[model samples]
Target: MTVFLIRRLMQAVVVLFVMSLIVFIGVYAIGNPIDILISPEADQIERERAIEALGLHLPMWEQYLVFLQRAVTGDLGRSFAFSTPALELIVERMPATLELAIAAMGISILVGIPLGMWAGFRPESLAGRAIMAGSILGFSLPTFWVGLMLIMVFAVHLGWLPSTGRGETVEFLGLQVSIFTLDGWSHLLLPAFNLALFKMALVIRLTRAGMRENLLMDYVKFARAKGLSTGRVIFVHVMKNIMIPVVTILGLELGSVIAFAVVTETIFAWPGMGKLIIDSINQLDRPVIVAYLLITVSMFIIINLVVDILYSVLDPRVRLKEMKS
Candidate 1:
């Protein structure tokens, strides 16, 4: 197990290095530095001085080396557009994005697994058919459109929640809380639900399929013949064995849920990395863009690593194989 973990960690490091190199080169290739270098009012000498100051005359390789060194030291440089440290700007916005992702995943897990179990139990039942049909419908809709519909229904038409911003001003536990923090939960209802809808549906379908397959195994029949209750035969005897693969799918899906939340965040005007990245791109804020990409890529690598390690823990067979090797 330890050896497997170490091997994964080393691969993760290499992948991150490659990702950084790609993003760095891509940003550099987008345009001439002089476009941002020379202001409209600057004279020729002044423009040349600015170029020299920024090392625009250096070879592309040399320029990339300098940028990479600074990045390694946690100095993403100041944002030209914001006049602020790029790292600082990203950190400030990290919480909102993380919060949204976590909330979405929590909701998906809570609702998805149960629905999946039900559908798997009686594949031909009315409830199962309805759940399967809903899952198909959900899988077909775009996230942005779902988010819009949620806003219209819950915020604009019904007035059950705020349309935008985290929440209304409120005091909690003697501390003043921002709407996004306090009433923010209320506001999350629509966005989080919208974000989770498709994920939950997919999970339900996968779980149902896996459960059905597990039920037909000889061990399940043996458990039933041994006088085990139907529930026990299905859940304890069948579900446990099939959960290994389902867990892997759930982990990978969770990582994707975070990655794809960018679109939902934008539609709702949520203050998260997604909106920040969009703004930075439009302004050509190189530092902020690089920092955001690094953080996001790092998250994916870390999540996948965690999922790999979990496989061994959840299934002793994996750990036993590792030990023998």
Candidate 2:
């Protein structure tokens, strides 16, 4: 186990290095921030000073080296647009994005699994057909449009929920979270569901397919013949087997949920990192953009690593295979 962990960590380091290089180069290619930072009428001398100050004076490789040096000490550089540390800006908004992503995943897991299981159990039933039909809609509709429709119905017409903002929040475990307050939840529900809709449909489909396949397995029949209760056969025998794939998809999707929440965040005016990154991009804030991308890459790598570890736990054969390899 220790050797496995060490090997994974080494791979993560290499991947991080490659990703950081890509992020830095990609952000640099976006355009000269000096164009936006300095007035068009600014003279050559003024432009030179601005460029040097922002380190555009250096070659691309040189600049990346400097970036790596600073990054080694936990400095992601100062945002040219905000006059603040890029990481600090992201960290401030991280909690909101996290909460939204988690809420969405929770909704997907809690609602999709049972509905999927039921649909699989009785695929021809009216309720099962309805569930499947809903899953199709969830997959087909665009997230931004769904968010807008939600705002229009709930906020514009019914006036039951606020259309934008994080609403009220209370600090818990050093993080500002809205889930603790009723006002916060009222603000949270629409966007969470909006973000969750697609993932829920995916979960429903995957779970249903897994359940259907498992129902016909010899083990299921054996369990039934051994006088196991239907609930036990379903939950303990069937659901347990299906969870490997479910967990794997969910683990990887968690990172994507955070990264791609940009659309939903923009539509709902969500004050999360998604909005922050968008603003940074428009301003051509290189430092903030680099920081955001690197952080996102790190998040994906970490989540994937965790998922690999989880695989061994879910199926001991996975660890045995690794050992044999």
Candidate 3:
């Protein structure tokens, strides 16, 4: 297991290096650095001075090496547009994004799993049919459209939740709750649910399909013949086997949820990495862009590594094969 983990970690490092290089090259190819440095009416000497100041005369490889070295040392440079250290900016904004992602994933797993289990067990029942229909609709709709509709219905029409912003000035349990603080959890519900709707449907469908397949396996029949309780045979015996695929999908989807939240964050005015990325792009803030991309890639690599480790623990067959090899 240690050997496997080391191998994966080395692979992740190589992949990240390549990602940084690609992003740097792609951005550089579009324009010269001097263009950003010089004003429209700048004289020739001024242009030369600006060029010298920013090291535009240096080779691209040298610049890339410098960038890579700084990145490895956790010294992502200041944003070109915002004039703020990229790493520090990201650190400041990360909590809001992390909180939103956690809320969304929690809702997806909680609602999707039960709905899927029920649908799989009673395929022809009205509840099952409704779940299938809703899942399809949820899966098919565009995320932005769904977010807007939710904002319209829940915020505008019903007025049950705030339209945007973290929360209002209020007291909870005799404690003053600030919108920018932990008390903001109340304002997070709509955005979290909106972001999770598609993921929930996908998980439900995957779980239902896996459960149905497990239910038809010969071992399930044997369990029934041996007089195992229906719930035990289904939930205990079948569910474990069915979870292999579900677990894999869930891990992959976890990263995707973060990516998709970019749009949802913009729509709902939720402060997150997604919104940060968008703002950075609009301002041509290279450092922040690179930092955000690196963070995103690292997230996927970390999640996938965890998934691989969990697979070995969940299934002895995988562990045995790895050991033998």
Candidate 4:
């Protein structure tokens, strides 16, 4: 297990390095920030100074090397638009994004697993059919549209929830969290539900598929032969086995939710990293854009590594295979 973990960590490092290079080069290629930073009426000397200050005057390779070195030392550079450290700005908004992601994942797991189990257990029932139909809509609808419809229904027409914003927050463990407060939770519900819709559908399908496959396996039949209660056999024996795949998907989806919540955040006006990234992109803030990409890529790598390690814990056969390899 230790050797396997080490191997995965090394692979993660390489992936992160390649991702950083791609992000750096791609962000630079988007456009010169100096064009936006410097005024239209600025003279040639001012333009030259601005370009030099941003290290744009240096050769691309040289600039990349400098960036790599600074990044290694945790210096991601200052945002041209915000006049602040890119990393600091991202960190400031990390809590909000994390809150939303966690809430969304919680909703997905809590709701999806049971619905999936029910559908798998009674696929032909009316309720199961209804759940499957809803899952289809969940997968087919666009996120933005879902978010808008949620707002129109819950916020505009019913007035049961706020349409936007991360409502009042109270500090907990040195971080401000909204869920602790009633008003804040009311604000969080709609967006988190909107963000979780697709993931919930995906989890339901995967879980249902896994449950169906496992229910017919010899071990499950043996457990039933042993006179174990149906509930215990299904919930304890089958659910545990089915969770391996579900957990893997949840881990990857969690990373994606954090990194790609831009549309949901924008539509809901949530003050999170996704909204910040959108603003940075609009302003062509190279440092912030590159930093966001690197952070997100690193998150994906880390989550994937964690999921791989979790596989060993959840299934001994996985660890045995890794050792044999």
TM-scores, each model vs. reference: 0.88, 0.97, 0.89, 0.96
The local lDDT score (0 to 100) that residue 190 gets in candidate 3 is: 84
Candidate 3 stretches with Cα past 4 Å from truth are 30-57, 168-183, 320-325
Off by over 4 Å in 1: 33-42, 49-57, 168-182, 320-325
- Candidate number with greatest lDDT: 2
Per-residue lDDT, model 4, residue 136, is 100
Clashes of 2: 0
**Full candidate order by TM-score, most accurate first:** 2, 4, 3, 1
| Global lDDT of each candidate | 0.78, 0.93, 0.80, 0.91
Query: Candidate 2, residues 186-208: lDDT per residue as tens digits?
Result: 99999999999999999999999
Of 3 and 4, the candidate ranking higher by lDDT: 4
lDDT (tens digit, per residue) of candidate 1 on 145-243: 888988989889999887675565355554333434547788777778888888888888888888888888898888888999998887687777767
Write candidate 3's Cα lDDT for 32-136 as tens digits.
645654578999898888666555667889988888888888887777666688987876666667667778888988999899989999999999999999999
**Candidate 2 accuracy as lDDT:** 0.93
TM-score of 1: 0.88
Per-prediction RMSD in angstroms?
3.4, 1.4, 3.8, 1.6
lDDT of 4 at 225: 95
Q: What is the lDDT of residue 93 in candidate 4?
A: 97
lDDT of 4 by residue, 269-312 (tens): 99999999999998999889989988898888888878877877
